[model samples]
Target: MTEFILPSNANDLNFRHRLPDKRLAPWVQCLWSMGRPGHLTESRTEKFYPDAGASLSIKLTSPHPIITLCFNKTTLIETLDTTAPCLGIRFKAAGTHCLLGLLPEAFTDTHYRLDNELEPLGLQGLIPVVERLYQSDSQQGLRLLETWLLHRLESQPPANSRITKIVQAIGALQLPPQQLGATLGFTRRTLERKLKREVGVTPGQLVAYARLNRARHGLLATTLPLTEIALQCGYYDQAHFTHAFQSLAYETPAAYRKRKLSQIYKA
Candidate 1:
């Protein structure tokens, strides 16, 4: 997985992130918090890339806090409310199934209230504790959250080893979708079904997500030419890369890179 980095304008908001405890590292990606800064007078937008993962978010600023699970199979752009303080737990690819025993396919590309969803799994008890911590100290809260996750992990069944292997293989981008199934000893149909149930995407979609993720990292982290970044991330050429990125991100690569650079310079 790519290292998590806050946006260039993160300092303007109350944003923080913590790595998951070692015991929970395989399933949990990172814990994060975001709040509107008191001095800020306007709302902002947050751009989410396609990561083949899900996030459990709690709107702590609400009168009655509610937990929402957002599963992203494609890019999402959402406006942030200036009055809401939120906490999030991002799950690794296929990690929701391992940790929560929920099929991700049911929640892909949308958000849903998790109250009813978790109750069926006997995990509704966790909601109150999450709310309590959000109202407390950040450091202590994160520690407590990790402790809770560890205890919850103990009660869950062992994660499917095949899913773990599949996630790793997809991230590595070592083979095409067709070859990936044969390499893993699964027929194409079986691979599609398995990935959809476990990861909320087909093998082809997951591979595309992985490639785009690598390309995004390259755009933000290095000064390499577009063609180099495209080729490195498995695209056929620069045109192919730009088209795919624009289709999902709603902006061309040059525009994204320029906008981000402008933000950093202004910051």
Candidate 2:
């Protein structure tokens, strides 16, 4: 997932992310942190792009920590107000189901406190660990979290190879949605049902996410023109790209590019 931080407030915020260790790479996407660079004085709003995954967020607060599970099918805009830093673990597309045994569809488009949710799975023990994680520095906390996730992975049954392969293919945008069933030796209907049950999205939706992810990076990371980025990302033209981007992101490509670029200039 990409975090869009406007330049005006960038200096006041401390945001960092890093990939997980190789052992946890298949399930964990990345670990992230957000907080004030100095004393926390005000709130900050951030925009998060859709990445077809779920995240576990831990906010360091008074008395006790605040923990939540966030899973969204579209862009998420949120404001943060905390004295201490917030930590998060972003799970891969099917990772929440593979590791936590939670149905992705149930948590779609919303966030919930994990206290009650984890109790049912006998994972309430994780609450304390999460609190400790918030207290630890980024390196120590990420290592501790990875160790726990590695242990959990050892106990859980292996993820379905076919589903994993399908997700990889879709994420890479190598397989067309229509050909997914044929390539995997399942009927289209069966494929759709299984994917939705496990991945929380249809194959087509996954493709859209993959394309958007690429286009988003292009707009933010490079100086490419919209027409060039649209064609490179497999859209027919700039208009198609703009419509698709706006439908999922609530902002047109040109607007998004301009806003992000303006931030860079001001920075």
Which is the leading candidate under lDDT? 1
**lDDT tens digits by residue: candidate 2, 1-267:** 333333235465666677887776766788777673245657877676676788888777666777788875678988765467777788878877877777787664577887556788657657667867755886677777777777777887656767777777777777686686678688889888888988788888888888898898899888889999999988999999999999998999988889877877787
RMSD of each: 2.2, 2.7
Backbone clash count for every predicted candidate, in the order shown? 0, 0
**Residue 248 of model 1: what lDDT?**
82
lDDT of 2: 0.76
Give a tens-digit lDDT track for model 1, residues 1-267: 455657555665577889998877777889877764233445677788887888887766545667888887778887665466667788888878887777887664488887656677667657767768655765666676677677778887646867767777777797776676787688889888888888888887888888887887899889999999999999999999999889888898888889888888888
Using TM-score, give the best candidate's number: 1
Q: How do all models score by TM-score?
A: 0.91, 0.89
Q: Which residue pairs collide in model 1, if any?
A: none
lDDT of each: 0.77, 0.76
